[model samples]
Target: MRAPLRSRPGPGAGHHQVLFFIAECVPFAIALVVLTIELTPAHVVYTGPLLVATPALAAVTMGPKGTLAALGVAVVVSVITATHNDAWGGQQVYTNLVALFLVGAASVVTSRAVQTRRESELNQVRRIAAAAQEVLLRPVPARLGPVRAASMYLAAETGAQIGGDLYDAVQTRYGVRMIVGDVRGKGLPAVRAAAVVLGAFREAVHYEDDLVEVISHCGEALRRDAALAGAGAAGDDAFREAFVTAVVAQIQEDATVELINRGHPPPLVIGEGSARCLTPAVPLPPLGLEEFIGGPPGRLESYPFAPGDRLLLHTDGVIEARDGDNTFFDLARAMEAMRGRTRQAFLEDLRDALLEHTKGSLADDVALIVVDRVDRSDPVRGR
Candidate 1:
């Protein structure tokens, strides 16, 4: 089996640390070299300016705390080196003190400016990501052609606007084509893979004549991107490991729903105070993991989705979610708890149950899509 994709650390935290460390050390190293060469008064004056400027540079790159720490180190180095050189008093000592004080003051100002700019950039990126998430996985309308739907997405990582989990629905000539998927990783690479899959799924759902063809098209798109990246040997395994597990379905006028499962957990069909899994007859390999001579795509499975039938499709994040005791979430048990509940109640109850099961924290991104066929006997809004 291929190794799972590892999430990259955020730039703001890790990058700041590395840059701050380098910035703090550079001037200290320069001072040491000057001391070795027998530091002169002229050298002391020139080096003093650099000692002050070094912490300011650190502030610009790493913000306030880092700048303050660098400044403290600079002061200690200057006082110790000067004392050792027998130049601790007189005009020379005053010059060093003035430089140290100026460096600390400059660092304070620069650090505040850098922190303000960083916060602004972070806010802007979060806004953009929020907009992108809404566009990519739109809220399921209160009602579709013959179904009422609702969905929820919760990213695993805190402050993460989006991740690899995806869902989409659209009214096409065929019917209400919908899908929910989970890419193999987290962070930007997984997000990029999700974008590729979702972009292809949207285009294919409207244009492709068959659901199987639509799934194949999405797989082909990812494969092409992997090849282009020269991910040749390394890329091939990455694509395989970065596979997407998904379930795609279409609802017909008579309430007959057809669906295909690609290595995804089966969706649950809830009706008449009972819940059951809609397992596909022939499950196919996940997208982006096609073997050299892959078997034909799975046959579309069909079932009668009578009025009041609520179908719940979700990523493994739901089942895989764990509690403090390390117990996995039992979705079936939760559904049983909500037996005979109204659509809205069912959703709310399920969300609450899941949150409780995971103790409000999940290790993977969770996406839930619920589709319910409305009762036809109920008053028709318009003939």
Candidate 2:
């Protein structure tokens, strides 16, 4: 519900533009003063061309009204200066006035052209960003089997639609399996790593018989991406330096939740009157860094996911967001504040609190999901 504050298009915002208009008038004022001097040189046409470039800059920083106003001022100043220089000679005055008009017209045309080009480029970039977001993280289903879920994602990057944080839910035979992960690094490298993890989950979740095997498939995907990247000299750096911290969970039909976590932020079990963090007892290294464990998969963590209980999963961005005093956002304390709220309402409130805590600017990507255990036995509750 809360989004970063973005600059509005069309004219440099508010009073900030008053300075630009004032600045644009300086060159014309200087050129006009030069023409009015008694001992001014006969050849003074060069100063007029200087006024032509002002409109181009105005095009970027000003609205159409402001841009035209500046251009109008430019034309008036240019005509007055030319008339004062050639007061006695009609033909000379006519030629100079014509030249100024021609150049002024060119400036207007150039300003409009530049604006058009810039607009086109912006439209293309937005389209591409939307497409990448759609392919990388499609909309999460509202209902995954018997579970009711609501998800939210906020990419901290201003221009980046897709970032390192990722989350997805799949209804597999194992149950409604879910994943929330963060790829190390940023930009394209991080996006690629995220894609690998999600692709593995979507492709192998239904086929893999064991939960650890699903994690293994995701690891192999990372290795393949590494090998492909290792072809270049700096390629293997991603293999060594790049990694993902993720938590994979399976929600069974009997309302039992199984979690396999690897150095990721813990999930919260939010019940009617209680909120508990599911921290791992023997934490394993991140999925890509399997060499540290050098053994079989770590045992799955189990929790009682009864009816009316909700599970909340999120990336490090939420906990690591800092305030003015350099204090990190406390997820546990925030959840405690949402004591009587529904799962969807909690996620919404959490997002708002995070934005306010960070002062509307974030240094990392955030992805979160809240899955509620449906009470099928209650006649008042409809599936």
Candidate 3:
């Protein structure tokens, strides 16, 4: 496979940071140039305009305090240049000082106003994102019916708490049903698709007895959402192509799991110090492409999730992560290495391992749900 594109910053990030530092120092650099020019014996060029521009340039990146600091340096340099040139009593020098003071004051006030407005907008965005996360990705209960479960969502984009990857688990009359899926696109469109699928799963899992029917409901919801979204934007049929790869699994009280995979990475069953992928017997297209099947719903494959066994459902982000050498992350090996920890700890260690393998740069959003089958008489020790 071609190298995956990472959302997190890479080697060039340091270079960009260096350029930013240089930009911030531009105001100081201007002051130094003025001082150097004044010290020259053959200097007839007036440096007043350049000195007056220093604080305004600093205001672009630095806040009010930094703007004031730049102004102070400009004033000190102006005085020294005036003394060196013996132009202290001249009207031109006095006019230049007055202009510098006025410009510096204006720059400081503008910088303070911009900083306040920016902070307010940032707070508003953070609040909205937090609310969206709670509704779109509700936390899976640590205990669901006969199993103990935990989930984690890692968004590849910086400052993003949620993304196209989504998962949810809920106790139902039939059994404990759970879903793990990834949307085909990114940003708002992908988030909208993810919300539609998850909303369908949360509602259908309780009423739909058959696992296949639950998945069918999710598929129908995706199409309806796409049609509605497409109606608003003229000539924007992109939503029609936005599909979601998902796996819906139901675990009965007897510790047996029935899964219907929709073009997603197969779930893992870990037990006795080994892990195995529960590949689906009959493959089905992703949710939006259900028309391609042209028959009954996807087959429900069964697996013996015995007591003490752990089931892991995840998006492709976990397995497709590549190290510096282009080798895929060894998820099975990592899971085996962290087998005996508690559900929460196991997931934390797994996340750390994934990050370490990719050096903290992930190409896609990751969503994971781990379910453990425990016998009530003898609760699993580390669970």
What is the lDDT of every predicted structure here?
Answer: 0.75, 0.75, 0.88
**Model 1: how far residue 374 lies from native, Å:** 0.4
By descending lDDT, how would the candidates be arranged? 3, 2, 1
In the predicted model 3, the residue pairs found to clash are none
Angstrom error at residue 289, model 1:
2.6
User: In candidate 2, which residue ranges exceed 4 Å CA deviation?
Assistant: 1-46, 56-70, 76-97, 232-241, 378-383
Candidate 2 at residue 318, lDDT? 92
Candidate 3, residues 1-383, lDDT tens digits: the string is 01122359533677887888998899999999999999897459988999999999999988999999999999999999999999987999999899999999999999999999999999999899888898888778887778889888888876676889999999889988999999997777788889999999999888888889999999999999888877777534656679999999998878689999999999998999689999988888999997899788777889989998989999999999999999999888888898888988888888888888999889888999988898767554554
Q: What lDDT would candidate 2 get against the real structure?
A: 0.75
Overall local distance difference test of candidate 1 = 0.75
Model 2 lDDT per residue over 1-383, tens place: 22343312222334656777776666445545544552256544355445565554455555455466656766676566656655545565566456655655665676677778889999999899788878888757778776877777888766667788888988888789999999988767788899999999899899987888898789779878887787767855754467899999988878678999988999998777667899988888887888898666787888989888878899999999998999999888888788657656777788888888988777688888888888655443222
The weakest ten consecutive residues by lDDT in model 1 span 1-10
Candidate 2 Cα RMSD after full superposition onto the native fold (Å): 5.1
- Encode model 1's per-residue lDDT on 345-370: one tens digit a residue: 66667767777777676678777787
